[model samples]
Target: MAEDTLVRVEHLAKKFCRDLKTSLWYGVQDLGAEFVGKKKEEDIQLRNKEFWAVRDINFELKRGECLGLIGRNGAGKSTLLKMLNGLIKPDKGRIEMYGRIGALIELGSGFNPILTGRENIYNNGSVLGLNKKEIDGLLEEIIDFSEMEKFIDTPVQYYSSGMKVRLGFSVAAHMKPDVLILDEVLAVGDSGFKIKSFNKINEIMRDAAVIFVSHSMPHIANITNKVLLMENGVVDYYGENITDGIERYFGLFAGDKERVEYNEFATIEDMKVYASAKYADDPSRKLPAIDYRDPIRIDLDLKLKPNVEWFHIKLQITDKDLKIVGIYDSFQFQEAIKNDRDLHHLKITIPNSIFIDGEYSITVFIQQRDPINSKWNLLAVYRYWRKFNMKASAGLGYVPAVVYLPGQCEVV
Candidate 1:
C-alpha cells in the first residue's frame, strides 16, 4: 500500500448461506476446523445453499480521493461497505486500514436507542478515539451543524430517520477521521441537509478518503472522482472515468420494451426515428447514436377509425434520469389533420436538436381534439417508445444542462 492510501481492499469476498440451520451448521464446522488448525482451499468455495454476496472485489482509496460505489439494488454495495466499516468480516480476502475510520454506513448504526442524542454524540466521539475534552471542544459545532439542537437531549428512539441521518453525518464528518464511509444515508435527509452534507464532504475530501454509495447519478457525478460499478457481487466497471462509469451504470437498466396504451380511435402501425447527421451504430448500446445537435426525423404510420378528421401528436423527451427535458407538440405548428383515408403517414422533423450528449427516450401521445370542450382526448399513447444516444464533440464535457445552445459573449 502506498503511504497516501488510507484504505485498501484486496480480492475481498464474502458469502452467506440462505438457510438458517445450514448456516449455523456451516459456522460450527468452520469453528471446528479453526480449532483443529485444519484449513482447506475448498473452505472458501460456495457450498449448498450458499452464494457470494461480494466476490473478487479490489480497490484502493488514497487521501483526498472519493470513490462512488454505484449499482442496482441487491448488488452487494451495502455488504461491501459493511465489510469496509468492520461491521462484518470478509469470508475470503483482506482489507487494510490506516488511521481513524468514520462511517455512516447504516442509519443509527452507532447510536443506542435509549441514549439521548447528546449522549450518543459523545459516545460516537469516544468510539472514534476522541477524549472527553476533545469531544467537548467539538460538541457545540456538531450540534449546530446537525441543526437538531432542540432534540439534542431527546432519546434517539424518538428521532426521525432524517434526524438520525443529520446527527450521524454530523458526528462522522466532524470527527476528522482519515477515512469516511457513507452508504445512501443522506437520501433520507431533506434537500437543505443534503446540500450541507455535500458541502461538508467537499471540505473533508481535502484530506480524507471517502467511499460513497448512492443510486443517484447526479450526486455520484458531483462528489466522486472515481467510480466502481458493481453487479451481482462483482466489479462490472471500475475507473476514474466517471462519465463512462455513469453511462455503463445506465446501460444496466436499458432495453426498455415499447409500451402502448390502446384506444379505438387510432392505432400506431409503426414508428421510426432518423438523424440527418451520420449515425453510429454500436451493438453494445441499447439505443442508436447520432451526433449532438443533429437534425432528427420521426416517421409514424397510423390507422385511424373511419371518418376521423383530425388528431394531435406530441413527443416528450426525457433524459437518462427520466426527467422531462423537452416536448414537441404538433398542434403548435400544424392545423388539424384532414384524414382522406383510413391509413395515414406522418413525418415530424426537428431541424436543430438541442439535446446535449447523453441517453434520451421519447414518449409519444396521439390525441383527438374534442369538438365540444376544445380539449384533447387521448386516442393512443406510447410510453418510452424509443430511445437514442447523442454523441457530442470532445470539448463539451459533462454538460450540466439538459440542452446545449451555442452562444457568444462580448466584454462591455
Candidate 2:
C-alpha cells in the first residue's frame, strides 16, 4: 500500500447463505413427497439460495480524505466496514490498510459484557492492535474525553446505554488510527456531550481518512469531500461531495419529483415507496414552525390500494448538528386497519414531547402487519423504500427549546 493511500478495498465481495424458505414443514413435506419419489422444486430452490452482501466493490480512501457511504438499509456500507475492521472476513478479494485502524461499528460492539468499562476500553484498544502500554498512557485522556470518570470502574453491563457509547467512542477516538470508521455511534448521548463529540470528530476527520456511514444526508454532504452512493449491492454513483451523491441517489426513488409527496407509493406498479427527511410531513413547506412542545398535527388523504391492511412510517429525525436524533416506526405500535374501503382519510396527532427541536426528517412504508393466521392476501414487503433551515423563535437558538429547565439565573 502506498503511504498516500490509507486504505484500499480491491474487488471486495461477500456472500450470505440466506435460508429463505427452509422450515420444519419443508422437512416433513420433503419426506412425504420422497415417498412418491418426487423431489420438489421448493426444496431445490431453497438448497441453491444465496444472497450477495457485497459484490466486487472497489474503492480507495486517500490519507485525510473523508468518504460518505450513503444508501438504504442492508446496503454494503456496514459490511464493508466490518471487513475493514477484520471483524468479518470477506468471501472474496482483499482490503489493504496502513497504520492502526479504529472502528465504531456499533455501540460497545467489541467490548466484553462482563468486563468493567475501564477494562473494556483496554480490551477494545488491544483489538484495534493497540498495546497495553499505549492504552495505559492514554487511559486518563480516554476517561476524561468520554466523561465516564465516575462509572469507569463499574462493569459495562450496568452502565447506561449513553455511557457505554461514550466509553466505546472514547477508546476508538484515542486510538489515533490512520483510518476511522464511524457507524451511527453518536446516536446515544446527551446534548452537550454530543456537541463536544461532533467537535472531536471534526478534528479527527482532519487527520484520518474517515468512512462515515450515516442516514443524515446533509451531514454527509456538509462534512465529507467525497461521497460513495451505494444501492442494492453495488456503487450507484460517486460524487465530489455528499450533496451531489444524495441528490442523485434520491432521484432514483422519486417518481414525480414534486416538493409535496405526489403519491403515497413510490412506484404504483409494484407499490414501492421512497422518501427523504423533508417528506415526513409537508414537503412543500421547507421548515414549518411546528410547535415542538405541543402535539404535531397531520392529516393525509389515505387510500388503501386494493388489499392494503396496515401502514408503517419509518421516521428519522436529526438535530441541527446532523447527528441522528431518533428513528421511529408506526408499525412498532399500531395494528393494521382491516376495513376494505378504497380511500380513507387519516388525521393523527403525534405528541411532540418525544423529539427535541432540530429539524426532523421522516421516511414511510405501509405494509400489512402479519398475515399467517389473519390475512395472507397482502403480506407483501417492499424491498427498497428509502430538512432545511428553520427560523429560531425568540426563546430558542437553532432549534426550539423543547426542554424547560426548572431553575434559571437572575440577571444582575
Candidate 3:
C-alpha cells in the first residue's frame, strides 16, 4: 500500500456454514490441523451446507475519499467490514490497511457494558493510538458532541441505544484515524443528533478515508464521492457515478416490486399499479415514468381478508432522502368506503406532475379507524415500486425537491 492509499482489498472472500453443528465441528478440525502443523486443503472447499458470505470482492480507498456501500440486507456488507477491520479473517485474498482505523460498525459494539461512558471514551481513544495527553485535549469536545455530559459518568449498560451511538460516533470522529468505517447505526438517534453526526462525518472526510454503509440513498449521495452496490455477496456495481449505482439497486427490486402478501393477521395482495396517466389506456402495460406535463395516476387492486370492515388507504411518495414529498389518503380525499368486499380497485390521480429530476418511490398504506377515538389505524403497508425518475428540465440547475409548485406572482 502507498501513502495515499489508506485501504486496499483484493479478491477478498468469506464463507459460513448453514448448520451450527457442522460449523463448530469444522472449527475443531481446523484447530486440530493447526496444532499438528498440517495444511488442510479441504478447509477452503465448501461442503454439504455452506455458502459464501462474501466472494471475490476488490476495491481501494485513498485519502479524503468516502466510499459508499449500498445493498439490501444480508448482502455480506458487515462481513466485509469485519474483515477490513481485522475482526475476522478473509477466507481468500489480501487486505492491506495503512493507518489508525476508527470503526463504529454496530450499536454498542465496542463499549464495555459495566464501564462508565467516560471510561469507555478513554479506552476507545487509547485503542486508537491516542496518548493520555491527546485524549485529555479532546475529552471535553467528545463529551459535548455526544450530548452525554449528564450521563458521562454513568455506566454504559444504563445508556440508551442512541446514547451509545452518539458517544461511539463522537469518539471515532475525534480520534482522527487515517480510515473510518461506519455502518447504518445512525438511525437509532433523533433527527437533531443525526444532523450533528452528518456534520461530524463531513468534517472527518476532509482528510481521512471513509467506508460508509447505509441503505439510505440520499445519505450516500450527499456524503460519498463513489458508490458500490452489492448483491448476493458480490459487488454488482462499483463506480464513481452515484446515480448509476442507485439505478442499478432500484432495478433489482423493480421486478415484481411488491412486499409480502400476508403479514401479522391481515392479507393484502395483487397490487398491480401504474405510474402515470399515459399507462392507463393499456393497464396491462408496465408502469411508465411520469412526464412533467402529464398527470400522476396510480391504480391499486386491493383485496382485504374476510371479516374486515372499513379501511383507509394512503399514497405517499418519497425522495432519495426518505422524506415524504407527496401524500394522499383515501379517507381524507373521500375516495372510497371500507366494505366487506373481498376485491376493491382504486385509481389515484395527481393533477400535475410537478417534480424535478430525481428518483422517487410510492408507498401505500392501509388503515382502519379506531372505534373509540376515530383515529386511523394502520393495517398494511407496501412500497409498490421505485422506478419513477422525473426528468430534468433544461434550465434548472438542481431541483432540490420532488415537486416544486410555482407560487402566485404577487410581490408587494
Candidate 4:
C-alpha cells in the first residue's frame, strides 16, 4: 500500500450458500470443528450450493480522494460495502485501513430501535469512539442537522425511513472520521434533505477519503473523481477518468443498442445516425466522431400494425453517466402522424451541435396515441441505440455544462 493510502483491499472474496438447509449444516460443521479445537477448512473454494458474492476485488483509496462504485443490482456492491464496514468477514484475502472509518452502510444500523432518538444518538456516538463529553458537545449539532428535534425524545422504532437516514448521515458526517463509506443512504432522503446531505459531504471532503456507491449517474459523476465499475462479483474497470468509467458502465447494456422489437402494434428498425459540417457535400454520412460545430441527423424506418391510428418518435441524448442531457421529440416538429400506412420512413435533423467533449448515448422512442385524448404515450424504448464520441476540441475551452446553448446576444 502507498504511504498516503487510507484504504487498501487485496483479492477480497465472500461467498454465500444458496440453500438454507445446506447453510445451516455447514454452520454446524464449522462450529463443531471450532469446539473440538480442529482447524476449519479454508473457504476459498465454493461448495455445491455456494456462490461467490464478491470475488478477487482490489482497490486503494488515498487521503482526500473519493472512489465511486457503480453497477447494476446484484452486482456485489452491497456485499463489498458490508465487508468494508467490518459487518462481515471475507472468505479470502484481506482489507487494510490506516485511519478511523465511519460507515453509513444500512440506515439506522447502530441505533437501538427501542431507545429514544436522543439516547440512540449518544449510543451511536459512543460506538464511533466518542466519549460522553465529546458526544454532549456534538449532540445538538446532530439533532439540528437531522431536523428531528421535535421527535428527538421519541423512540427510534417509530421514526420514518427518511428521518432515520437523516439522523444516521448526520452522525456519520459529524464524527469526522479519516475514511467515510456511504452506500445509497441518500436515496432514502427527500430532495431537500439530499441537497443538505450533499452540502455537508462537500464541507468535509477535504479531510477524509470517501467511498460512495450509487445508481444515479449524475450523482456519481458530480461527486467522485475516480471510479470503480464492477461486474458479476469482479472489478470491470478502475481508473481516474470517471467519464470513461461511466462509458464502460453504460456499455454493459449493449443489447439495447440499435435493436428492434416486434409486437402486436408496431415494429421499429433500421436506426441510423450521422453528423455533417455546415454545407457539407454529403450530409448523411456516418460520422466517426462528433464536433460541437457540426450538425447531427437520424433516420428511422418503421411499420405500423393494422388499426393503428397515430404514433410519435422521440430522440434523447444522454451523457457518459447515462443522465439525459437533451431530448427532442417529433411532436415538437409536427403533430402526430394521422395517415395510416403499413410502412413509414422518418428523417430527423439538428442543424447545430450543442455538445461538449464526452461520450453520448442516443435513445429512440416509439409511442402510440392515447385512444381517448390522442396524446402520445410511450409503447417502446430503445436505449443506447447509437453512441458517439465528442472531440475534446469540440469547444474552444472546457465547458462544465452538459450541452452548450447557442444564442445571439443583443444589447438593449
Candidates in order have lDDT scores of 0.88, 0.65, 0.80, 0.80
Lowest summed lDDT over 10 consecutive residues: which window, candidate 2? Answer: 266-275
Q: Pick out the ten consecutive residues of candidate 3 with the lowest summed lDDT.
A: 392-401
Error (Å) of candidate 2 at residue 112 is: 0.7
Candidate 1, residue 292: Cα displacement in angstroms equals: 2.2
Best by lDDT: 1
Better of 1 and 4 by lDDT: 1
lDDT per residue as tens, model 4, 1-412: 5777899999899889999999999778767867997733353467789998899999999887899999888899999999998998887888998767878988888889999999988887788789999999988999999999999999999999999999889888888788888999789999999989887777777888899999877688777878999999999999887777776886686433455443446666577666444424544534346567676777888777666777788888887656788898877788887546667888878777678776687877878767688676666677677876665443243344677677799999
Give a tens-digit lDDT track for model 3, residues 133-180: 999999999999999999999999999999999999999888888899
Model 4 TM-score on a 0 to 1 scale: 0.79
What lDDT is obtained when candidate 2 is compared to the true structure?
0.65
List model 2 lDDT by residue over 111-168, tens digit each: 8888898888888787777788988999999999998899899988888889887987
State candidate 2's TM-score.
0.57
Off by over 4 Å in 3: 34-43, 254-286, 297-324, 327-351, 356-389, 393-401, 404-412
Model 1 lDDT, full chain set:
0.88
Candidate 1, 1-412: lDDT as tens digits: 6899998898899999999999999999988887898855446688999999999999999999999999999999999999998888888888998999999999899999999999999999989999999999999999999999999999999999999999999999999989999999899999999999999999999999999999988899898999999999999999998888988998898545678866567788888887434444445655577676677788889887876778889999888888899999989998878767767899988877777778788888888888899888888788888877777746645645777786789999
Give the top-scoring candidate (TM-score).
1
Clashing pairs in 4: none
Candidate 3 clashes: the total is: 0
How well does model 3 score by local distance difference test?
0.80
